[model samples]
Target: MERRVGEQYRITSKEIDQYDDQGYLVLKNVLTEKELKSIDPIFDHFVAGNESEKMGKDFCDMSQPYGTPIEDFQLVNAMLPGKYIPSFSKNIFYRIAKNIADQLYSNGKAAMDYEQFLAKKPTKAEAEFSMHQDLGYWPKTKNTWTATFSLALSDADVINGCLYLIPGSNKETELRSHRPKEYGTATNEAVNRDDSHTLIIESKPNDKIIHLPVKRGDVTIHDERIVHGSGGNLSPDWRKTYIIAFRDERTIAEERAIGFTHSHNDEVDWNSIIK
Candidate 1:
């Protein structure tokens, strides 16, 4: 059964154990129909190429470099929707995510680290997000409690590009090397060049990649260090997703001290930029 707007979804110890072992968990029917209705229009507004004055960042192609033409783009994303749409933070989905995150934390406390909105346009074969760990994009920090909650706004399947993850990859103590997709053989210093936002790691031939397909309202939670990515949307329907991440407050401060900012930190006047 789906949870109501104000109702919370209880997280079981078994689920926590599973998350600890596999580094990911899928909670089905976490959001009710009413809650979906409230947020659908907000996502649609961005997906349709509309911009709001309050939005901190504009949607950009994740598959290509920063200034790639819109028509040539495949997967597009907007970060920190809660910054522009206040209701997004107040939604039941966010509350349930927090509840689950609190349970996963050793100290029983968690704070909002960041959030994002992503969409895979229909039939975009090159829209796939390559395999990489979330910590690969973050600044080096001691915190390891961070987790990301991905809420699907539309049905996701193999045909429409669902999430794929390597089981137990989070067990690795060290982060693998990652580089910008554009710089095929360039040094890690190429990441500082800032030409491309997409960073990827090479997948091993023996890695066990599992595809997770879910209906709208299902939420998938994954550890920050998990090796994960999604395929391109080949079906006619769009695959839209909302992501909220949480971590210990101390880690958040450490990341800030290192001058690390999310890709969505760029605030722009939408009306002026979008005609």
Candidate 2:
């Protein structure tokens, strides 16, 4: 059975309102070093597969931003590892994370929908994600309001490419047009934004961008519609993040679906993309 809100986690009403207003909230040291260590064995298993270039349904490899068939696309993103490694689902980290999601999502009533893990290799410092909403990639879901939790298994600082959010970006309930793949294509917003000032550039308007440099056990929750992405890992430490996504189970958004299902996992080559 799933957990309910206000049962195990203690979050102030004010904090919930803060998340509503700013589109994100950060909880400090939600797990201890020992708690994080309990998850290491599972992560190691995925890492081993990734290091060996083993790509599969669960072990997903990040494609080169250019969407080529060349030798560059090798960074790995392991999905639903808990399903493959049962110990991962039963770990203390999962329990604490689930409890937190149960408390903060859907006015403290949402349930767990999906979870994934991302390991940013130190050498893949150039493999950064474009600023876009998670909703753009997901299928027609019954819930539109999703609470995404990102827990850092290792220390994530600006040097190691920590996550960042565009404050209040989720206020618009409409889904923006996204490119076909995680390749370096810009969203419709990027293409249509006012061109007078070079609207979208690397870390542009640095003042408005919120960089999340969290430590081990730190968790950051953000509205799924918020424009969030991370920099490339320039540091030697591996940036490992465990992500849990929660949904209201009823908030649906299919009216604006533009009918594109191509995502990062699609095996389309660069030449096939309609430029």
Could you tell me the lDDT of residue 38 within candidate 2? 76
lDDT of 2 by residue, 1-275 (tens): 22223324466778788888888988877777777787776776776564333334345444343223324433446666655556557456566766766666655356555677777777677756556677655555555677788889888888878898888878866655555442235564432111110112233454377798888888899887787787787887688888877676443223224332222233433322222
Which window of ten consecutive residues has the lowest lDDT sum in model 2?
192-201
Encode model 1's per-residue lDDT on 1-275: one tens digit a residue: 43334566777788889899989999888887788898888888876666634442356777776666656768978777776667667566677788778877777368888888899999998889888998777666676678899999999988989999998999987777776577343464544325666778999888899999989999999998899998888899899998889989888887666555464443322222211
Query: What C-alpha lDDT do the candidate models reach, one value each?
Result: 0.78, 0.62
Each model's TM-score? 0.87, 0.73
lDDT of 1 at 155: 90
Q: Can you give the lDDT of residue 204 in candidate 1? A: 86
